[model samples]
Target: MVYCGPLSKACLPCRRRKLRCDLRTDACTQCTRAQLTCSGYRDTTALRFRHETNAVQQRVTARKSTTTIPRSPPLSIYCQARDIFYHNYVFGPSKPFEFLLSVYSQTSKDVHLSRSVDAVALAYLNAQRPSGSAELEARRSYVSALQYTSRALQEPHLAKQDSTILAILLLDLYEKITTRAPAFHGAWATHLDGALALVKLRGDEQFIEPSIRGMLIRLSTNVLISCVTSRRPVLDDLVSLRHTIAAHSLTPPDPKWRESDLVIEFAKLRHNIDTRVLADENEVTFALIELDSKFLELSRQVPPTWQYVTIQVATKSIHHYESHHHIHPAEHVCQMWNTFRATRILLNELVRSRCMDRQGRVNAGSGFQGIHERATRAIKQMATDICASLPQYIHGPSTFDLTGSPSASSDLGSGTFPAGRPDPRYHLPCYRLIYPLFVAAQSSVVPPSLSKWVVDQLRFMADYHAIKNAMTVANLLESGQRTDVGKVYAMLGSYAFVC
Candidate 1:
């Protein structure tokens, strides 16, 4: 037999076993003779460290001498921006849903998605520093993202991918957080429209992956809420998705599922109420009544764990406040309850408004008055509950000195939350209450003092959280008050208030 060479390369199994490999082209000869499977040779091209000998040291020195030295540290702006976006927005305190981090990490390789992430991150950074170059960079990335997204959309194969859908969602968020103007408002709506269409195109396949399903559900909820708050008609495709979700309720219970189900039902009911009021559809009144009943049932069906349980303690207080009631639940649960109560108030108001006499005038009869009273009571209670659920920092004993401390409840009513470093409790995961707070503030039924407190909270959010929309809502509330628009809906006009 002709000698090939000395055995420098050995099969992995033989090398690990520290046995002679008898290097062969395919299976090693020794392994073959022993009837052992050969795992083939290890790759020698990969970079690795080894004990340095004289030869290695000399070679390394030679290479070091040949290579050029860098002048500055490597730039990681893109990585930094991505991390900021993920932590501050995707996993922020106000986000109620848990996004699968792996989904973003994996799909971040897509050009459109990466550009979108950069765009949003830059926009948020710009919000923190208004006169920065971040805005210019954000605009550039946004333009690039739009171009890539358009190109992706032109390709049927890429458009249906989850990454493209995620890119669209990010673009929508960018629009929302970047600026607050009448002109920019429709940009988000347009992105939302495209996202919903893509989700529809995916159909059941979207639900096959849990992460994708969650994303689609969130998108649907956003769209539904937008339509309701903007006084727009609910899309038929979204209604179909709602029906699908309702049918799947028999499946195992999930918090996300319950939330999506609740929001969809609420949207449908709100749309129906709006429709009935505008069209004077006497024929739709029965359907509206049925929807109201179903909404109540859905509220009851909210997972018991998600419900807020209030606790009352009798205390001999040294402070001036009369009531000493405290609600104990995760902030998100409290917010959900507030939303439920607010929606009920809206429903009641809508019904009362539609109950007109045959002369096409508002009914001031006993029935209308009773409903009006109930709606007023609901709005006041909702306002109280919203304030009660605020972080302890907003209405805690720490707000005043111990010598002659004011009651926490009084402190809340006065719109005085101590100003200093925020309490760690404020950093806790909680749903953003801006929408509910705005709703309560604009309710004619709520006392002006309580509404002022709500407005203060909105201003606090704008200053503290860098949420631009909070400032917008506060401005809207101020203008509404000045204009004597008694109802929040009246003040909103065609503009949608979304969280």
Candidate 2:
């Protein structure tokens, strides 16, 4: 063989194998020693430029023909559904799950994760446009995901993976999206329990990793919601998990994390009252009062960044509060504030119910009246504030006119949901509004008109948005059964669907 140049001296075999080439005038010693035939090198000048010939022209002509009309490959229905889900939930304004954007890559390697994502995504799409074929496909994907998750759980190595926990959580979300009834003992709660158990199996070490820590916190929140709604006591294991998270976390806990501790206390108090753990009505009222105070204290402690502007909408367009709406610093902050208001509403409602139940009796006293009056005012105010947050969700940030500067509306009376505005930004916030609006509507202290407005919002969510839980809730409100709307929320509107 003849030497071309220094760079081109490598035999084809050495270049292909990525081995260091010995530039020799004859066969390379490296290839010869390996008993391989040394394929000769190409000309250095030829390597610098393309050699256009009949074959190259033919290939180029064929490529140009194929490229003449550029067409994007058509995405499958599953891909479209997944994209829609991400748009409405993951990458949407709410960005319900912070970890999803990062953990999605794991789906490439984890079959359970991919299937679970597809299952829930398809279910979410079907909620938008209910069809038998879409529903059937979603159900099939869900079943397949569940089978994979069940098999994964039996394998210790696979069971410990974060993707496995996410798969379980996604399945839980699918059940919530698809299940219409308010039952808690089936797949919905089971997945929540399974995800928690897996986290517990991982133990304190799990908290050292930020992603696992996030999932742990999410799992705890879901459990707390489920326990409060179902009237079940917070489990001791969860209490331990929260402590471990606090202890093992590398960063200082944020406002929401601290608020979660308060929520846990509130949940525990609610459970105690629900289970008759506090048999005396006065004792329950006192506990409610105490928890409310703590929640308020934490609310005050949150950084100023958590503060929101309450704006008065100038028009009587009727999509929102009669007088005002709120704008928060961030979507998460808005959600946190709404959570605070809703929790206060629920707490105060409990207080009023307990205090009033003991009213006009031998045990009735002036102190009971004071507590009842305080709770009544709180319920009314919180209900109104929750209403104030609605317009920001419905119209989004752009359409909101903060400069209108109208007087604040004291009540949540608003018009029916707006039509012909199908902005994607509105979807997640509307879904989140379900529970708070349900709470406000169900509150005995809210004016009948405001209650009706809240119900109408739910009706719109049910009718226009096609949210099944919203339909169940709307029906429940119209029936005036005084049911636990929170239970409906936790059972049918899983946190998986929300965050």
TM-score of 2: 0.77
Candidate No. with top TM-score: 2
Candidate 2, residue 141: Cα displacement in angstroms equals 1.5
The C-alpha TM-scores of every prediction are: 0.66, 0.77
CA shift at 397, candidate 1, in angstroms? 15
Total clashing pairs in model 2: 1
- Candidate 1 segments exceeding 4 Å error: 1-77, 88-100, 106-109, 128-131, 182-188, 242-293, 311-328, 355-366, 391-419, 423-431, 459-499
Backbone clashes per model, in order?
Answer: 0, 1
Tell me the whole-model lDDT of each prediction, alpha carbons only: 0.59, 0.74
Residue-level lDDT of model 2, residues 160-244, one tens digit each, is 8888988877776787787665646666666677767777787566676686677777777777666666666777777888888
User: Global CA lDDT of candidate 2, please?
Assistant: 0.74
lDDT of 1 at 488: 39
